[model samples]
Each structure stands twice: as structure tokens, then as C-alpha cells.
Target: MKEFLGTLGQTTARAYGEDLIDFSRWFEESDGIELVAGLVTTLDLRDYLSHMLTVRGLKPSTINRRLAAIRAWLQWAKRKGAINDLPVFPRHLSEPKRAPKSLDRVEEARFLRSVAREGNVRDNAAIGLMLYAGLRVSEAVSTKPSDIEIGERKGKVIVRNGKGMKRREVPINADGRGMIGPWLAKANSDYLFPGSVGGHLSPRTIQELIKKYAYQAQLDPNSVTPHVLRHTFATKILRSGVDIVTVAALLGHSRIDTTAIYTQPSWRDLERAVDGREGGNGE
Candidate 1:
């Protein structure tokens, strides 16, 4: 598996490595099942999927990803004559149709106020990038001083470690400038958000800090995550008449189909649409 993964890109390799490691651990612990590919059957794969869904409580997307990774490994092993009989891959579970989580205007205002009051320079800057620039947490943390170009009038965030290793520059708006400016002035390390011990801030640390800020803002901590901030950024801009292509570019999405998910109307939006059409005194 490692050898097969080695031929892939860094991001893909790392994800497959983690997925294989998890599968190995589960295989070791599961009763009456050895880790050998030849010994595993289609039923065993189904059981593994069941374990992921029931025991691990993984979401459909995550479960599908794990299954895909394992299937790839099994296919490679079979082709290499390592395993004569390969188990059938488990069918992917259908993802539920649900609207993406995003902050409403009121919640966004409250969140901004909370950050101003309770957050430090780095906290403000990190939130700014994800909320305004549509950056992933990993992209924000891995950003270096050289990756940013902030001027008085305009600025851009040079995303180096974006998803799928795709690099892009995201323009920063007025709000982003205000938040990142103070942080940049005080930064002494190579990274934008330096860690206490050494490298850039870990994603887990950022998650915890966001949770703290959410509590301070009187918002639901579970709903306010870095990705939710990104969603909020995209949804707000899209609502304000930004073209989907531009939004997709800013968000570093390779496919417009992926970005189209944000086009789904919120319940509040649907309510407004219906309210606008209601008869009003017969004009």
C-alpha cells in the first residue's frame, strides 16, 4: 500500500496512508478476521463498512473515502499477484441532501464582535482568512509571511497548501485587511500563526480556539467551525451578486459542480421568496 501510495501526489498519499492505517487497526481488532487480503471476503468488507458507520460513527462522505482508499489498495495488491482473490468493494453510502452550514448576517455580526473583544491578533487574522478569503484551516496555518502581500489599498493571500495541492491567490477585502493588518505587524515568526513549541499552529488547536470564540459569541460551538466560516464567506459573497465562477476561483474549487452546492437556497431565503409573492391588499 505504501509503495502504491508513493506514486501518488503528497496530499493523496497522506490521505491513503491514514485510511490504510485505520483499516489495519480495525482489521486487527475485529474478531475472526485476519489482516491478510486473501483471507478477507466481500462480507468482511461489508462488515468493515458497518463498523465505520456504527462503531466509528463516521459520516457518509468519510466512510466512502475510507472505502475508496481500501479498494484502491486491494486492486493494486491483486494486480501485483500479492493477493490472488480480492474482496468486492463495498458500495458507497449515499450522502444525505442537506444544506451546508453557514452563519446568517446576525450571527456573523455577533461573531465579528466576539472576535474583536476576545481574540488576539493571530486569532483575528485566522478568522479573517477563513471568513473573508474562504481559506481552509490548513491553508491559513501553513501560510508564511512571504505568502501574503498586504498593501493599504489592496491585498491577496497566496494559498500554498490548498486541497489537492492546488495553489491560488485569494484577494482580501476591507474586512480582511483590517483583521490581518494588526496581526502582520506583531508577527515575528516565519508562519502567520506560529505554534508555541515550533511549527505552524495545528488544525486541532485552531478548532479549539474557534470553539472558544464561538462560545464567547454566544453561538453554537458545534456549528461554528473553520469550514463553516468558509461556507459563510462563499454564501455571503454569492448572495451579494458575485458570479459563481469568481467565487469558485476565490475558494480554490477546481469544479463548478462542487461550488454549486452553495447555490442551494437557505430556508430563510425560501421564506423571503414566498413572502414576496403573497397577495397584499390586491394592489
Candidate 2:
């Protein structure tokens, strides 16, 4: 199992390993059964799900995540011939829909101002990719200097290491190009954002940089992560009347459903809609 997991990306491998350990402990301690991949059955997994929901009080979303990890590991084991048959996953429990968190326009302006005040050229460039191009932190750090093409009006950024090891090109709006220009001029390394050890900056380092500026800017510190910036990009672009399919393409999302989550209107938008209707009727 350990050797198989070693083939995955570092973050994914760590998470899958943790999920496996949790299931193994539950299989032995709760089921009092020897946990072997081939010998496990659908009934056993069903029981495990029941235990997680009833005793462990795990939410449907969490259980779904665990099931995904376990399923991937089991499939790998089966391919290696370590397991004869894969255990069937229980029917997934439905999770409530929650809108992705993103900063409103007012908050976004304040955040950018804070970044300009507290951050360097590199920081601004990094934030620009997330804010405009919807690049994930991992993808942003993995970007090479050669990946960007910033023209006066339009440009594109190539995400070298996107999710699932895929690559895609995203357009960099004028604002993004302007934000990235200074760093691109002075960039010394092959990487867009070089790390101390001579490669791209670590995701944690990028995250910490954003967190620092977020605090100085007086925004909600908790909401200043790289992912929130991504959500902001997606949400803002979608609200700007871009089609969901186009938004998904820009975000490098494999499925349109993932991008549809951004369509949920915010309270401000709902209020505006209501006010517009009432004003039109001269009420």
C-alpha cells in the first residue's frame, strides 16, 4: 500500500495514506476482522460506513472523501494483483449544497491594495494568477517564467502542473498582465516564483505570503487563503456574464458541474435583483 501510494503526488499520497490508516483501524477495532484487501466484501464496507456515520459521527462529505481515498487505493491494489476483487463502496450519502466562499468586489479592492502596500513584485504576480487566472497554489508555484505571455491587451498563462497532472492555458486579463509585468521583467530564474532552494516556491510559502498581506490589509485573515482567491476569480468572472463552460475552461476544471457551484447568487446579488424588480414596477 505504501509503495503504491508513493507513485502519487506528495499531498495526495499523504491524504490517501491517512484515510487508509483510519479505515484499517476501524476494520480491526470496530469490525474485529482481519483487514485484507482481496478478502473484504461490499457488506464489510457497508458496515464501516454505518460505523462512521453512527459512532464516529462523520459527515456525509467527509465520508465521501474517505470512500474516494479508499476506493482509489483498492483499485490500485487490485491492479497489482494484491487483491482479487475490490470491495464495493456503499451508496454515497447526499451532502447539502454550500456556496464556495469568495471575496466581494469591495473586499477584493481592499485586498489588492493591501498586497500592493505589503508585498513585493513576486507576491503581486503570484496573487494575480490566482485572482485573475484562477490558478491553484500548487499550479501557481509550479509555473515557469516561460509559461506566461503578457501582451499589452491580452495574454495567456500556461498551467504546467494542473490538477491530475494535466496542463492547460488560461487567459490573463489586462489587470493580471499589469500586475505580473514588473516581476517578469526582473525574473532571474527559470521559475516564475523561485523558492529559496532553487525551485518554484512551496505552496505553503505562497499561502503564508498571502496570509501576511491579508492581515495587514485588515481583511478577514481566515478568508485570505490561495483557494479563496481562486473562488473569487471564478465567482467574479461568472458574475460578469461569462458562460459556465467558459469559466470551467478558464479554471481548468475537468467537469462543468464543478464550475456550476459558482452560479449560486450571493446575498448582495439577490438584493440587487429584488431592488431592480421593485424599482421597475415604480413601487
How much does each candidate deviate from the true structure in C-alpha RMSD? 9.8, 8.6
Q: lDDT (0-100) at residue 258 of candidate 1?
A: 91
Residue pairs with backbone overlap in model 1: none
Q: Can you tell me which runs of candidate 2 are displaced by over 4 Å?
A: 1-95, 266-283
Query: What is the model-wide C-alpha lDDT for candidate 2?
Result: 0.86
- lDDT digits (tens) for residues 224-251 of candidate 1: 9999999999999999999999999999
Clashing pairs in 2: none
Model 1 compared with the native: what TM-score? Answer: 0.64
Residue 162 lDDT in model 2?
A: 85
TM-score of 2: 0.64
